[model samples]
Target: MKVMIRKDSKGTLSAYVPKKDLEEPIVSIARPQMWGGLVTLANGWRLELPEMAADTALPITVEARRVAGGED
Candidate 1:
């Protein structure tokens, strides 16, 4: 799935994911912390992005994969 990541006018990071990729329509929005520029979705999918500008709109690809134990 593809997601669009950008910083809102208030300087908060935001991500927009398509409903087709989600299990259900989002009942609420959450401000999840980003760890190393990665955010895990409720559908068990993950998105990783590089360092981006505050006003940058980044298009990122999300895929499902198994992580090797303890790998970061």
Candidate 2:
């Protein structure tokens, strides 16, 4: 699925799923840089993000895999 990753003004990380019309704050990250790892959303969905540069810009949309979550 496609997920938009962004940082809010308060520096909180969030993920927005366009197809689902759902947005949730990222509660945990499997890796410090957050790339090539898993991120858990506040709603309990786990998504695997692709590898990217450590300095990759935010608010960017990228392809991600839904590792664990509810329907779709």
Mind sharing the TM-score for model 2?
A: 0.93
**lDDT of model 1, residue 13:** 45
What is candidate 2's lDDT per residue for 1-72, written digit by digit as tens? 999999999999999999999999999998888999999999889999999999999999999999956334
Ten contiguous residues with the weakest lDDT in model 2? 63-72
The whole-model lDDT of each prediction reads: 0.41, 0.92
1-72 in candidate 1: lDDT tens per residue? 445544556655455656444332112222343423555544444455444444443334343232233112
Candidate 1's error at 8, in angstroms?
1.0
All models, RMSD in angstroms: 7.7, 1.6
In model 2, the clashing pairs are: none
> What's the TM-score of each model vs. the native?
0.36, 0.93
